[model samples]
Target: MGRRAIVLLVALILAGLAAWAVWNFLDGVRSEAEAEQVQVTVYRAAEPIAEGAEGGILLSGQELIVESTEEQVDLPDDAITTQEELNSVLTGRVAAGPISANAILTRSQWTEVTIDVTPLAELIPSGKQAITIGMDNIGGVNGFVEAGDRVNLIVTLDIAADVIPADFPTLPDQETGGEGATGEAETITVTYTRYVLQGLPVLAVGRNVRLDEDAPTVIDVEPDPTTDPGIEGEPTEEETGNETVFTLEVTPEEAERLAFAFENGSMWMTLVPEDFVEVETSGVIIDTLFGGNLLDDIFQN
Candidate 1:
């Protein structure tokens, strides 16, 4: 019980205090690690959900499977965290697009199903009439053109001199000295291509029609396998040989021009962007094509 004894006791007390502090620090670290590893229940698709499928179908058909994932996982902010949340969000909603199996269900993946069925005629503007044109894949922008796209039409016509009426006044042939020109002129065919229409709004593409501009186009449901057994497999867009049809909204005068082009000339559609600018284009014939300085400009660049 002297000075040395007192100093030894003080040292032991300090050592015990340091041990307690170290133990507490380690315990807090362990708790934090456990908290970070905590799991939360989430909903995932058990099978493929077709676009436009209702949210109620997920619960009734048991298409959603509950999965326990760490809260720290990269889940979407609107991720369905509980069965109650899923039911609340999906009651009358439909999938925005095709949801693959095991995809985490999120609020952004579904949207309110539009109940009002808009008629096709109602979609066209008052001043516009819908005109449909059919073409091969190559001429139809390789079948990549959609209903809401804007397109420009280029028409190629091969005009033969014989097709002109006999009574039509004719320029005297300089080579034939104007005498032989009185009879039917020698048959000559000239091919020319011109941009006939620009910035035409496409109303529909093939069988897929856009009823509402804001809403997603309703996709046709797949034929039930039980009813038709002849279908081998769904053909990709590239594999199908069917002709692509584009329905455009145009004025009555424009429709007549389009009909003339469709009947007597080959037409090709060029896809244009929403902010497309119409530029003045001179019709192209063989003489103008070869006479232009386009080759010089290309090489100079």
Candidate 2:
């Protein structure tokens, strides 16, 4: 070998060794930093953790908040990370079994319970079908219809001379008594509104359950100013909800009849007293608007 070639080979070996040593040193420093133990906050009982206590109950500011051991910890995946996370997902979840004081909390210690998830089907009793009817301000009693309340169902139907039912009666319009025998025969359309189903129980309004018995009567209430009207979803029933539909419990036959009336005509409901009392009356017709003794009701007052 040439003298210069041997020197170059020796230089190359030394440089390679130095580079490998520097890389190894950096890797060791990184591992040491990572291996350094980290302190994680966990909820530890200041006193004996009794059975049935909340798994994620908030600690008083002075409570003995705890940190993970100085020794490296292999915490279970279910270990709660923050007080806020514990409060939100674990609050009110009672301890399924007892836990010892100063012991780290685990998901297994608490019972999983679901809140505010009652389904509409559960509200309907056996042998009855739930029928939902759509309504607006006029038909829905201005958002007064609530679950467990009784309502009187009324139907307003248009009867054309061509398809009028034989059983259904019609009355003449007083104002437009019609060209009795005029050259151009005027077809008089009659509108009859019948109070069909009395004291039907309301099962639900939108997604809300029944109101408390002591809940105050609802009048026409303006939307809460604090409630962001811009925000949208199902509104909180009675709190912020503008209810647009109501479900009623009815027999199969009654449901079929109600569905027919809903498809054919406009249906309305009047909320009756909790003690639903039926009123005696035949259905109202065009004549009843003014032709009946109803005129006396207006004149008398």
Candidate 3:
């Protein structure tokens, strides 16, 4: 071939090699893009999950859903991506806080199970004081009183003549057999039962407490029926413990009254409804109790 023709041929060969190289680079780029677009299986919450709820229960109940989604380029490093990882890491853990529905599961969302005991100070509302009272099963509503419940406190006390005012009028001494006879005053004792505190919020039951007004009480657990007395009418000491402590949220003045009643008078707790309305009570004494129509109404009914 001539020199000019050979130079042209060599130029064509070099151009072809450059084109092949560009094609190979483009194909590699396309492959990498496709790989990055592959779908990945991830876990997400199907329903709202309460804080401290078990992950396994959530998954089994379909509260947590598994979905296949395109791998996100900007996905978080701690995001849960695979079934194996979720089962190993999150199934045994609990949500660190309330998880909204459809939230992507992540390592930071869960934590190891821990006792959820709320501090007593945290439970007391602003401007309220926490006071605890110890009572038997009957007084504690057969161990049914739970934290976050509302209750009324009834106190029974004995009033003696010494506690009565000294200025009160006195009748003539009958034993002296004289009219308007001035002598030592006669002593008398009377028992009265009246409601001391109404609509008091319970702060804690024993050691278990509720975190917030909306949160479920941590100590509200159903008693096991198998352990309850089947044939015996009355529960034994082993079945119902001697005392259950009830922590109540009260004002400073109410706390003082409760302390006095707890110290000197018999106090009983009566669970009140959420919409309970306070009513003026006349209080019960021997005369009022016996003279009222309560007995007649009961027998008539």
Candidate 4:
């Protein structure tokens, strides 16, 4: 080999050794990565676990704590490492069984709760959706409708028969009668209302049942003449026969229609008697209000 060849060969051998050293160093660091200590919070029982209380209730800092442990430590499956995981999840969940004092809480110890599921989710029928609608005093059954009551929803629309421009560009022609379509353009406004949805179970009324707890909340929805529920005997101007919001259970398809109706027009609620059964009726409209008795007296029924 020439001298130049020998120099090149030596340089190549050094570069190979340098590359091997770097590779070996990284391999060693990777091997120790899991063995490195990390600070994490783990649950510890402070007292005897309640029969049905949430697992998180036992997780005060005094009871649970953050400690340094190897990343590869043998953690129980129920181990909670973060506050959000604990609060958002484990906090409201009931224990599946009793937990002994000083026992570490693990994922396996408590019943799992679906995230964002309401406490009253059990009441919602499958294939249905829960939606809220805004209502004034009259639309809310005058504060008589409770959360579990059934109601019918109606919408009132003011349609105006207006003379709009033709679909395509056009101009008035005096030579051809000089009159707008169907005489001079004018709007004939009409007030009409119709039932939109029926047999809807009231899921919530006003702000009282927002939490979806099993029992009706202590927050009184209606005014009482003799009690403090009416805001110090005489209700405040705002609280007397004030507006209430209602949440109802509806089929997914009906939810879309109801949402569209709510946005497009005003809604009224009609409370239905629990004992009364409803037969299918082609909902009432202004055109049918007189039926066959168009000329009958108003009070003749």
Candidate 5:
């Protein structure tokens, strides 16, 4: 009786222990699976995102702690604002400055450098030439042209006005002197005049032009082609003109018009004051349009 009882009690106790062990293992696994993951909530505006926008998303960058003040950014109407959208915005690269207000972020936003390809114009076959703020061989300084000035280009055709001499008849030398010979007659040919037409305003000032020997003469500069450079940061304005000698800052659309005008007609940089109102349509034709001509045209028109 004692041996049977003792063996039965030992077996029961071992079985109970085994069940408890199994229960504990299962409980541990469930707890691990339910554990919280490292996460942060990034704030994003409520707007759709562009396919390849200038900015969005913030990874490891200048951290901006959440404050009482509401963070803001400028966003287009169709910008995106969602975790998945944010991921896509940042897929190519992240830019500095507030992600567009319409952009969405998983956690927070980071700003990287931004790059903009603006439109500009340069002389063809001339390479890049610095825009000098001076005058030429005229009464006006640099033709009175400045960095932010505008003017019409008029070309003078002839150095001097055309003139013609008339022929004369010789009177009877026999009546006056008898043996004397008659005088001969002579005449001169007339000369003609012409002028070059003026082109529309196509050029804009891109920063003040300065003298630089390292830069090449501006032979050709149109508008920036790439809508999005896909780079994370924007180069400084000076950097944009690294290879450019004359960098004319203008709108993309305006760039097209300027390029067309430059190619179609004769374009000379004429300098006019900001408050200038008089516009000359007809005047003396010259290689460059001067202030005198502009004033004359305004009155004539």
Candidate 6:
């Protein structure tokens, strides 16, 4: 009886020890599996998203269940993940995508492109700046007259007047004296009796106006050229002077007009300010010939 009882008791003790060992091993395995299942975050567009969304857009995050594909997985509705949160789950590493939502979405074609105000410097104009309009002293160039540079604006008007020469110059008073008076004068006087279509003061003149240099320039925006200056009238050997940079302070509406003028007319810029108000606008095709003194002959004669 003693031997049988002792053997049975020993067997029972060994059985209990073995069961405990199995339980401990199982517990460790479960713990390690749980730990291996890392919590990761991934971003999902608020709307259904396609791959290649355009760069720089907002995105929302969703939490995900991830592990070695061995343990029980749980992806709950409330799982929280950010670009950083889901990097490991989505891209196989933590912090893979940009930290910001916009940056992460920038590469995606689906993302909308955003244009910042900083890049549109040329299309906009500054306030309270003086811009040159009409025939400019800058050799007839208009837009180059920047916001601060002193510029004289010359406008042409059609007025019937008595042409007088300096020798028999129509004195300001005498030119208006009689009708049908025809004389060659350096100065011509428009009679008040004449009906002027546009009126007497054809030019609105401004001097020494300050330019808002910070104003955006709207002209032909070309990359810096590597060539030397080309000869006038001959057109450049390679790249001719195609674009004219007109720097001026003008209202948005006026800017439209200036742009139109640059496209249509022969414009020039002159550094010198002239007081030749009585100059004739007609017969002065001097601008077309590209700097010839032909008009000088007409004036001299």
Which stretches of candidate 4 lie above 4 Å from their native place?
Answer: 1-118, 159-190, 210-243, 279-288, 292-301
The positional error of residue 114 in candidate 2, measured at the CA in angstroms, is: 3.3
Candidate 1 per-residue lDDT over residues 1-301, each given as its tens digit? 9999999999999999999999999999999888777577788877677777777656655335556564646777788888788888888777788888888889999888654566778889998999999888889888778888899999999987765557455766788767432444357898989999999999888766765857666644442222222434666453464438889999999999999999999999899988999988899887678667666756888
Candidate 2 weakest lDDT stretch, 10 residues = 219-228
lDDT per residue (tens digit) for residues 74-142 in model 2: 666677667676665556576665566677766677766545444667667799989888988778888
Question: lDDT values of the candidates?
Answer: 0.78, 0.69, 0.76, 0.66, 0.40, 0.37
Cα error, candidate 4, residue 236 (Å): 8.7
Q: Poorest 10 consecutive residues of model 1 by lDDT?
A: 223-232
Q: Give the better candidate number (5 or 6) by TM-score.
A: 5
Please report how far candidate 4 places residue 16 from its true position, in Å.
99
- Number of colliding residue pairs in model 6: 37
Candidate 6 worst ten-residue window by lDDT? 194-203
> What is the TM-score of each predicted model, taking all chains together?
0.49, 0.48, 0.48, 0.40, 0.27, 0.26
Candidate 3 residue-wise lDDT, 1-301, digit = tens: 8999999999999999999999999999999998777566677777676676666665555334656574776566788898788887767777687778787888898888655655679767799999888898788788777778899999999988744345445666689965553345567888989999999998878865745766565533332232223423676543564437888899999999999998889988898889999878988987679668666667888
Error of 5 at 245 (Å): 16
Which wins on lDDT, candidate 1 or candidate 6? 1
**Pairs with backbone N, CA or C atoms under 3 Å apart (clashes), candidate 3:** none
For each predicted model, how many residue pairs clash, with residues at least 3 apart or on different chains?
0, 0, 0, 2, 34, 37
- Candidate 2 vs. true structure, TM-score: 0.48
Best by lDDT: 1
Model 6 TM-score is 0.26
The local lDDT score (0 to 100) that residue 284 gets in candidate 2 is: 78
lDDT, residue 89, model 1: 88
